[model samples]
Target: MFKRVLIANRGEIAVRIIRACRNLGISPVAVYSEVDAKALHVRLADEAVLLGPPAPGESYLDIERLIDAAKQTGCEAVHPGYGFLAERAAFARAVIEAGLTWVGPPPEVIDLLGDKVRSRIAMEKAGVPVTPGFSTEEPDMETFEREAVKIGFPLLIKAAAGGGGKGMRVVNELKGVREAVEGAMREAQGAFGDSRVFIEKWVQKPRHVEFQIFADTHGNIVHLFERECSIQRRHQKVVEETPSVAVTPELRKQMGDAAVATARASGYVNAGTVEFLLDKDGQFYFLEVNTRIQVEHPVTEEVVGVDLVAEQFRIAAGEKLSWTQEELSQRGHAIEARIYAEDPAGGFLPAAGPLLYLEEPRGPGIRVDSGVVQGVDVPIHYDPIMAKVIAYGPDRETATARMIKALEHYVALGVPTTASFLRDVLASKPFRDGETQTDFIELHFKEWKGETDQDRQIALVAAAILPNGVKTLAQNGGEQQSWRQPTPWETLGSWRIGGNS
Candidate 1:
């Protein structure tokens, strides 16, 4: 086991890795930008190193700086939590070349699977079902146009290098093909520094499901089953649950086997996710491979009763998988809701402000993983995700109900959040009936305005109870004071039960 490991990321994921390291008696080192000097992850780690400016290019994404930080801290391994350089093959190679263990798949595997176009070809060759797409050695407009026509309309122009909806476009008709392709290429260049794009037949109303796979240096591999991540907006998942309502016992085995085969073909090791798109007819097609721990991994952990991060440590240490396929079984239902500091009413745009107050929900079967704390300023330099709230129960219904309650109790003032929207989605008919698909948000909440009388009343009550004097409200024909801030003694009234005020 390594004595120390450096977490080369920030936000909730960094805090998550730190806790895991502490449990295993490994000293965790954290790297922070100037803006994150006081971040929760920095405070939790055994030691902290300052990266440069807050910009990702200067701090989190700088491979040389990250390697240097780990070496300077005497870390034996580097854990690149989910974002930033987590999936960057170059970063992983750099860590290996620096004589430090990388807590992820081999760099060669990452390089093979990171390119969406290349991965598709590999999966097809390995007999794994993949969506129909076109990829050539030298891509040109003439080739793209011919392939687009053959693939039919309602196709997607996706970035060959990156994920997260960037460098992606939906082309619904022939007339828009040229503009869409050009725009996607430009966006892809700016986001991933790669100008490559590919065309694929878009499967309409498909469910996004992924299998959690683990492998070791001894060639042992097993899948932890599937996660239904169909609840999404803007091509990004907001809610994920285990034991997908759509997957049956037989289908689970088939998908799990396919996922394992794909991993083996890529010479993969450590933790990774094999994502697939399941159509209405029950046919599943390989989408892509996330060569790192997924953000929605907690749901899998809650159901399988396994610590994935701990498994990552063991695998990186050259230990064989601790459990066999038959030993792992899904015990209960789990759901995860991502809480982002974004305004749902304003098109879910990221909001930046001080966390005036924060009250995370707490209870049995409820877990809150957060990076921000009260009084911390949420800068506009990075992802807006503030926390993740996960709920587990004996069944899907119970889990869904518990999640709704948890979201209702979660509070973060001075900045709008997606809490209310998440609560509504959990309670919606489609989600309750398990009719989730990639178009869930668009189909149900395309023009959603997160306004309600109950919400207004709560805001009004909160304002009236503040220490400052209450503002006056205009009545039918005149202005009147709805209420006034009360002092401790004033609230006691003229008399008490056994004593005078």
Candidate 2:
């Protein structure tokens, strides 16, 4: 077992992994940029290291600096909570070379799965179902055109280097192919530093479903079921729930099997997620494999009663999975709503300032994972996510209802959040019916202008009539306005949203 582990990321995920390490009696180490000097994870860790400046390129993403922190701190292992260098193959290999245990899969597996084209090829060789796609070291115009004709129009050009909707394009017509190809190549080069692109038959309105699978050094693997991540905005998942309403029992079996196959093919170890795009007809295609824990891992943990971070520690320590596939069963539904500091009304532009008031929901089945506290400044230097609100229950209906209630009660001060918009989503009929997909946000904002008018108006009216300090007058003994109810704030505006008083 690792006596000490360094968390190389920030925000809620860092705090999350720290708690898991503590539960296992492991000393937790945290590294932070200047902006996160007082961040929750830094405060919670048993030991802390200052990496560098606030910019990720100099701090969190600096591989050499992170390795130095590990060596100087005498950490036996490093647990990358996710993001940063979590999926970077070189980072894993470096830890191993430094005589430290890497609490993730082997470097070779990361390299193979990190490359989209190689991952697809590997899955295919392992008899896993994959989407029809073309690969070329360098594609020629004639070869591209011939392949397009055979695969049909409406194809996607994906970057071979990384996968995040970056360096990707969709061509709907023949005349658009050349332009789309050029644009995709340019974007791919800019984003991933890799100009290599490939063509694939694009599926419309695909539901994003992923299977969470864990493997151990003893050739043991188990699937922990699926997460319905179809509700997305700009390729970012806003709402994630387990027991995908779209997946039937039989389809679950098939996808689970395929996820296991993908893991086995990669010789995977530790926790990983296999993402798939499930078409309406119940057919699913392997999209890619996330080589580390996902942001939405909470939902899976809720329904399965498993602490994945703890499991990762056990697996990396050369222990086989204690539970088998048959013993794994998700008993209920879990829904998670991400709260970002970005404002949905202001074109989702990012917002940063000192947090004056921070009130998060708490109670049975409600979990709030946050990174900020009152007086801490929200910086524009990192991802805008402020916290995640997750709810679990015996079924989706109960979980969704609880999450919506939690979002309403939750409050933040310094910056605007997506809380209300998330509330609207939970109330929408389409979401209730579980009929969302990757394009849900486009579909959400298509009518967002007029649809949110009432909510906007109601919020305004409530504020005007019931400002924090505004009082409701009451008469005593037939006297007019004898007493009043006073609130903490008498003003209503951006400034009143936060204050120590």
Best-matching candidate per TM-score: 1
Task: Provide the global lDDT of candidate 2 against the true structure.
Answer: 0.83
Question: How high is each candidate's TM-score?
Answer: 0.92, 0.88
lDDT of 2 at 126: 95
RMSD of each: 9.2, 8.3
In model 2, what is the error at residue 171, expressed in angstroms? 2.7
Report clashes for each candidate as comma-separated counts.
0, 1
In candidate 2 the C-alpha lDDT for residue 362 amounts to 82
Cα-lDDT of candidate 1:
0.88
The residue pairs that clash in candidate 2, if any, are 469-489
| Candidate lDDT (C-alpha), each | 0.88, 0.83
Residue-wise C-alpha lDDT for candidate 2, range 137-187, written one tens digit per residue: 877777877787788878887888766677777788777777878888898
